[model samples]
Target: MGSGISKARRGLLYISYNGKVQKFMFDRKATSRDIQEQLAISCGLTRLSNVILKCRGDVIAISPSMPNNTPQEPYTLEQAGYNVSANDIIASTVKEIGKQFRQAFMVEETKREVYNRVASIESRVEKDGKRLMEMEKYKLDLVELRDAIYNKQTNTLDYNRLRPAITLPNHFYCPSTEQESLISMARDIPAYNKYVLTNETKEALKTPQFDVWQWEPNEMLILLEEMYFELGLVDELDIHPATLKRFLLRVQENYRNNPFHNFRHCFCVTQMMYVLIHGCRLQEVLSKRDICVLLTACICHDLDHPGFNNTYQINSRSELAVRYNDMSPLENHHCAVSFKILSSPECNIFANLTPEEFKEVRGDMIILILATDMARHAEILDAFKQKLDNFDYSSEDHLNTLKMILIKACDISNECRPIQVSEGWVECLMEEYFHQSDQEKKECLPVAPFMDRDRVTKPTAQIGFIKYVLLPLFEALNKLYPEVEFIALESLKQALNHYERMKDFDENKKKLFAGPVMSKSGRDWYSEKQMVDEGGQ
Candidate 1:
């Protein structure tokens, strides 16, 4: 027979040498000499003959009288009473082979004991390894949960506050309350008039024609505070003017410098809300608390916007989406940041409000902010339309619906501005839209048809949006307040006419250059736009 056997004839054996145990496979019929030679080569030993192989702490011996079992005979492992199937350790020591023989009665006991012990040890080791891996994975998960849900340093979830406090604007430093009070006192003087707006600016701000593009950031900040004062919110809400200034400053600080959804868009929306309140005479009709809620919601509606819409958040499975479970993630974030600012003692403009009042305001603000999500446009418009026919201002439900419609109207009211002003906003919106589309292309996500700059022209972009979204919303609001038709609806209609003319010009230009016509696919584009807009922000 050959010294080596096929895999099927090989059985496992454990070997203990140099204080370490290792597994080895041996032929089932391998003799002591064959094993000794193989081990010597495998273990890098220079000599093999002098090695003593022990089973169960005694030397393996063959009786001299046994056939082929003389003291020098090469006996198979089974002849020495070792079961290759048991995979028992063959303990070897580097010494002369001993002449001792284990009694016959002990052989069976030793084989069974070795098998049980080896099997037990291996089973335990495998189970322990798996347990260790599981425990390690669990530890990592706990640490992640702890970090995400709690502040490690504070060891508490500071749910009310956002970390790394809002940055103070230029020309302002972190001032002590004493200093702030003194500044407020000085500002109360008529001579300290730098923050005051011109009569023309104030009057202009009261109308829809107020041009946001004409103001600088600092000027806009002052305008916002002045608007709050002009609305009597500062007095009715018991807002400390100094505290209000700080809050507005922090609000400005939080808005990112995106192409469109930055501080300017925020101011424009709030200004439009102001225009709506006055244009519709809502100040006389709506409660003071309701007007306060409307204005505050408009101010903080798009706080800290990252410029990407909800569709991207959901599609990309972004952190914000995961944080809010993909339900109006941006709107939820806006509310969180808004309240985060409010939670700060220095910026808590609503501090004078009772707990119940604060809760009511917070809830209303959340509703208004979330209503700005374009996906809810049709739902909110329909609900408002339903209420307009009954039009009971005394009904809490009807009043709340009007507040929602007002904020929604103001949020997208750029189209209601004068043509020159509205055109500038369209450019800004286009820039932001194109940026998002470009990112979608880079990330291999579906780009919104209207946002794809290559597929859409300026006129095409605004035309469908005006026809489908803006006119319907404002026209509904006009039903409740006929005065709004002249104030805002006229501007919207003029803007629509201007874009229509521009669309014709664009088509003519395309015809002159032999460019592909978009009118052929106009219906498809508008349909896809509505679907995506509903699914998107």
Candidate 2:
């Protein structure tokens, strides 16, 4: 073959055989059949009929225009997109099988196997493409639904006026007699060792002014139990007091020792929710079941907080972010931990609920807990605001939105407390912020401006948070429930003013201390020091 083909006609081809690749020379005008005949002869085959040719793992027939059994003109190297002059090696494989019956059968079976694998891969790709299309369609459907309800272009909500008013379900009502007995039963149930609920403590627990720092851990646990009992949740939900206590203990234990997002903070939020539920007269507006959901959601909202915010979790690419796909990672972990504790039969406070009831409560609790994520703060607040003017206690949509706002209100109600209490919480929050900022520095991640210790002061931090974020929320709540003005809104305003004064004092103090310094020469100390300094010499 080398003597027959001229140097210009010689072309390089790489053939893979028996798990090894070898180079071979062929004529540029040689067809695949001629190359196969040469390879068969080199392999000691008596006839070319015994050799099967494959290119790039696919079987290549001897003839291009017809079957191998038929006689027709075959494609040359150039016709197959191979440039021999450019030394482009055409990758081919030679699967040698004798003309024996078993060898031919095996070759045919191998071809079927390759075809089957290709078909399988194609099927999977098709299925995955279909699923992606379906997901895209579902996302578009939600967008369409949102536009139908509220058209952003016109700033109009067409569905707002279309919703018919609804009435509270009969089961949602709490009987006065039953509630009184339930309170008595809850109070009478001994919760902790040597801890008694005195009149002062009971009264304090009823108000948002209840100081979590004042009570011992055991005392706080008892108080948490009392709130659930006092709200008639234990009796109405048929939760055994021991079961409720176990659940409370589990919740308290799950909360890590973070600076601000700790068990004490959890207690504070739950107590605030309790105060809101009573002070706002929400029980008359909502059902007993709804109250239960509110209190429970507050208790489990910050469970297992790691002292780090969601931003850090996402930016760090933590295990939590991977597990929850980077959407509200910490919040999602909180929900997971909450349900995990509830999964234990001994700590299952809602065990008495039917499957349907449990499912609804579980869903509501997740929604409320997830709502506490600050990323969704604006969305939740705006939704509540839109529903506020025509707020209906009977409408489920309106009621759930209110429940969301209620939990959110309680969650951040620390500033709405007495100045002393709110100030203490501010310190705790700043500590947590600084801790996270330090970690961000160590990890070389972007630090939040408000969290940067070098950039923030107590007064500067509280001013914007209260003015922009806290005030509008509380003021809006005050419109629907006038009691909020007395309970929390006033306190928030006072807190804002107190911080502003402190800010002013800080500025003046800076100016006072920043005055021209006097020296022994009665000149500016900085100027005198510079004169005497070595650099001045």
Candidate 3:
């Protein structure tokens, strides 16, 4: 019964042995001394102990201390515990079996752990990459949606292509991808571009019978741009540009009074505010967020104004004045309407603003709009002059002073613009005042100066107004804004010239001058210091 066996090469220990005639298995873990004494004669060479064990079955027999050397007999073993025939002796003399098995097992376990960890990391990276791609796709989709809405092509939206819903960890859920995309897209589009482009076309189509010609889209757009730009100036003012577009859309849809206080008026005011912020250097004093609020106030300052001045409300005990106890009734109404629009989720351009920012916006807007009331004009002018008198042009506080001046300037900005523009506004105002006068007389009520439709020499009164009222106001504004003085002077000079050119003309001119003088005692009322005292009170 000869059998083969493998041995531990490094340890020089016998792994197994074979036996036919007889053979002895050497311990693989045996020390050098043991191998030299016990196994050297049988093993042949000291270093060849492992080879001798592997070739155990080939030899015939082992003779102790034979001359020179002798071939070893194959060694075989019988099982000590299980009674099973053994081909070779196990290499257990040095406990080698236990050590080798433990080493192999640990190596396999380590390799497996490393492989699993690598797989997990790769999986996580793949998942995150996919999430990022999805988010980017959503953003692009929103931009497309905004374009479609501006073009009024919402019907063309491919709703089916949008995701059902996307929820953020913050609990904000965009119900449909299409909706989210549209709103987001609107954010980047300039709200007033179309208005600016179309203003001339609208104005060109106007006729006296249908005074809609004065409604210039471009002018309106300019106004909106100014307001939006100002709002963008405040710190942490998180107003979305989309909110402003929505607000403008609402104004266009609901308020269409033909001339002054219409959409065009809002537009102009908005642009005027912008000019104040940048050209007038108010940006240094007001925060970007305050600018937005100011712009909003400008846009909505005369909203739903009904084309009548404060005198109409006071004289009629109008519902608006009565409701607000005649305390800046029109101003209060305009501010309330603006805020009401802002309260809508769709109109909350400043939705991301802090609570404090929102409060400041509301406060600034109210103050500015209320200041626009003509009754407050004198007071505003007086305060402005006083501030200028004590001007500290070099102080850091110059910005604040500039803001106050700009607001007041914007409130009466029409008086300081081109003569033609100012005259156009005055004409519109006079017409509305006369219309109201007609209504008053029809209702059997007494009417005030410009409000009374039936009167003599209305045109001459208007010319006198240019001399006493308009010219004085312009002179004051010129004193404050030397750069704008040319416009104010030109406007007053033109009005005066026009009056003089026609003051002595014939029959047709007399017909044109038939109505009562549109002038009143308070035409220069805005320039008095008394007005400022009343305003402060």
Candidate 4:
């Protein structure tokens, strides 16, 4: 190491690429080239040709071939106009990278999906072309026969003729082999269990880990199928694993490429919901139907969120708010869009269930999904609090109240996870908040508090949120389910303490940045103190 070169900051370096976040850290003596090589590896890029490093809209890439393993001259953090702190976001502008990559990939994937779907539909048309006419004839003949028989013999119409009143005897609307091949992918379940489930480095079930960066949307179907298998819900619920995979693929496809509210967030929330369910043994309290709905709702709770809050929707007079009459518009949209996906022939994972069962599941799913509305937070919180006021474990309403509370907790449980995970989600949320703020500014609407990135907030705001919002919610939960919330509450307390310290540091930093400090000789109080002090050396 040269005298001029210094050690780089050793902390978590989160690499966001193609809608996937990979966690890594640079070596202390890492040069610019080292960073490039590490970044390439961390982002799962095969070659460095396409990789571009940007900071605040400025390109940082200097050469076509980035440094391999060769050690090079060290670059100063100061030279790069950055600070090497204990907890630093080295790639501060990585959100833009994620956004750009997601847009590009989404476009390409959308084209592929559209092409496949069109081809499948065409193939179906070609195959069902004959049956289509037959179905039409059958429908026409039945209508005509029924009309003539009823007209001729009024009440004495022969029931024998109408015995086989089948409208399209075959399910022609069902998915063809081509469509099924597109929708479903056979998974190596044993590999998933061995690699993801059994691995020590992977996050343990119900045991929160520092890694909260969502698994890539590309890997969602496999992970979801494995999740379904791990919970034994496939056999219990009588859902074929292939149907579940199809359902998941459709759901994931529909999720918009928003920074925070994408399919990755859905997986994250579903992961949290899994922890809550098994950790609290809510399954023992609630029926399998309720449990299934709870988990499923977590998956579909934020489908197609447009990266705007309810207030923005109402103020902008968005169609969603208008359609829902300003009553949990996003929640309603999520439920409706999700159920519509489920209703598709290829994606109907719940098709095996009876009509009553399906209805109950959908109804419960809607209730649970709608419960994620922040406006209903206070209402749900108060209602649950009232339940806590008069505790009853056996009551069905009480159980549902608890379910609502758990789902709400899981929805925002990003903070309840390990600190690294917590920080990752906070960054994600802040990015989303800043985007909303930018939109609000463009629309001439009042920017929401703590949303605008220009007006920086101290850790005080986070501390307040954890204390005021999450603390009470988790506390109430902990009272009912003792050990279930201990880990989460402790993490919250730790975060609170951290923010409190950061608040003091921010105050001091503000003082330094505010103005020039007054010298002792410049102050009249100095002379007064000297005169008051006896035997001052």
Q: Please report the candidate that would top TM-score against the real structure.
A: 2
lDDT of 2: 0.76
| Model 2 lDDT per residue over 1-537, tens place | 346877766655455555555555566577776766675555445432346656545566643232222112222211222233422232221222233667879999999999999999998998789789979989998786677678676787766532211111111102232321211111223444667688888888878787777887667888988888788888899998888877887777666666688889999999999898889888898889989988988999987677788898889887677778999887787787788778878788889999999999999999999999988888988999998889887798988888888898999989988987779889889988997899899999999999999999999999999998899888888889999989998888889899999999999887654553433445456555655773654
Q: Compare candidates 2 and 3 on TM-score and give the better one.
A: 2
Candidate 4 global Cα RMSD: 30.6
Select the stronger candidate by TM-score from 1 and 3: 1
Error of 3 at 431 (Å): 2.2
Per-candidate TM-score against the hidden true structure: 0.61, 0.62, 0.51, 0.61
lDDT of 1 by residue, 164-277 (tens): 122122111113223222122112212334676789998999898888888998788889888889999889999998888788878887776776788888999989888877
lDDT for position 14 in model 1:
55
> For model 2, what is the error of residue 365's alpha carbon versus the real structure, in angstroms, after optimal superposition?
0.2
Candidate 4, 276-295: lDDT as tens digits: 77677777777776777777
What are the RMSDs of all candidates, in order? Answer: 32.8, 30.4, 29.1, 30.6
Query: Candidate 2 vs candidate 4: which has greater TM-score?
Result: 2
User: Looking at model 3, which ten-residue stretch has the lowest summed lDDT?
Assistant: 164-173
Candidate 2, which segments miss by more than 4 Å at Cα?
1-193, 517-537
- Candidate 3 residue lDDT tens string, 5-28: 344422222323333333344444
Q: Let me know the TM-score candidate 3 reaches against the reference structure.
A: 0.51
Q: Where is model 3 more than 4 Å wrong at Cα? A: 1-215, 226-236, 256-259, 276-278, 392-408, 415-423, 456-474, 504-537
Worst 10-residue stretch by lDDT in candidate 2? 164-173
